[model samples]
Target: MKPILTATVVAALVAIALPAVAQNASQIARVRGGASCAGCNLFQASLSGLEARGLNLSGARLRQADLSLTVMNRTRFSNADLRDVEAYGGVFSSSNFSGANLTNASFVGAYLQGARFSGATLTGVNFSGASLQRATGLTQSRLNQACGDEATQLPVGLSIPRC
Candidate 1:
């Protein structure tokens, strides 16, 4: 009976500690040069289903990160390194993405209306089912390069490019 009670206690403690241990996001934003991002390194972090509206993440490194279903309205990602990140179903309206590296990033089912992408490298990015109406620095040629799906919403008459 004593051994069983101890085992149960140990198991409970381990179960409680497991979630905290698993939620450690890699902090790697220790670079110089940026107004909003002075210090932060968030590589491959799991930010899925988080409500981070109006957050300042400028110049943050989030490569290969997961930001699915995250509400990022008015969020600032200017000059941030977001290569190969998964950000499907996020809200990025009125967000700033100037000079950001969004290579191979996917924004499926996201609301990116009024989002800015000026001077950003969007090579191999996917915007399938995402709304890009009124998004800055987003052109038809850019869309062609990124290759979105048929459900992607553009300004007008802008269909997804063929892969």
Candidate 2:
């Protein structure tokens, strides 16, 4: 009985520590590689200047990540947690951001042409100097909470609100 209890405690501790270990491994991989942490916990990771095109990051936790100047064209970010992410000057053209949490994300000068943001949260997102031409799933209510400028391009029939 005592051995069984110790084994159970060890199992529980391993389970609890696994996620942290995985997160650390993912961070190391991102540094060694080009920020390619698919389905990994990258919470609050600073991936500035990352140049990983066509990388798959689906279901990854990237909340509060700094992705400034990253080149992630055609990358997949579906269902990723991107709340408070700073993607200024990042080129994410044709990227998939479906069902991602993008609350308070900054996309200033980011190129998002033909990107898919279906069902993603857009509260307080900054689109200043960003291009959203041909982007999908954007609503007026969501845009109302976003900040954009004249240089920001929207989808057809979508008008930009005053910043």
Candidate 3:
């Protein structure tokens, strides 16, 4: 009985020490089922290779999520929290990111043609090899807050610092 009590206490301590999963499983299921899950909590979600087009994820919390190779063309991510997301090789053409927080996010080799970035926070974002040639609502000030490699393609007369 004493040993069992000690084990229970140890398990409780371990659970407290670990970070809690803030994602909503039901919302994730909805997304998986090809449903739009606006304002959902998707923290640290692994959504690689997902091919959902026109997804409406506005106001969602997608911090530290993995979107590698995901084809979410024309998706809506307005006002979303996307900090530290990894979106390598993803196709997000014409997507909406207005008012989104993209701090420290990586978009290496991603396609973002004609996307909207109005009022989006681009601090420390890595756009290495990403294509944003026809993106809208981008200013020099916004680009200055982010970084890209020489292979990154932007609209004519606009450039970002090498990452």
Best-performing candidate as measured by lDDT: 3
Each model's C-alpha lDDT?
A: 0.77, 0.85, 0.93
- The 10 consecutive residues of candidate 3 with the worst lDDT sum are 1-10
Local accuracy of candidate 1 as per-residue lDDT tens digits, 1-163 = 3455588889998888774432223342222111233235667777787775676788777778888998778888999888999999988899998999999999888899999988888889889888997788776666667868778878875656843
TM-score-better candidate, 1 vs 3: 3
Which pairs clash in model 3?
Answer: none
Which predicted model would earn the best TM-score?
A: 3
- Model 2, global lDDT: 0.85
TM-score computed on alpha carbons, candidate 3: 0.87
Model 1 CA lDDT for position 147: 69
lDDT of 2 at 143: 85
Q: Report the C-alpha lDDT of model 2 over 85-133, residue by residue, as the tens digit.
A: 9999999999999998898899999999989988888888889999998
lDDT of 3 by residue, 15-134 (tens): 999987788888887887778889999888889899999999999999999999999999999999999999999999999999999999999999999999999999999999999999
Please give the ranking of all candidate structures by TM-score, highest first, separated by commas: 3, 2, 1
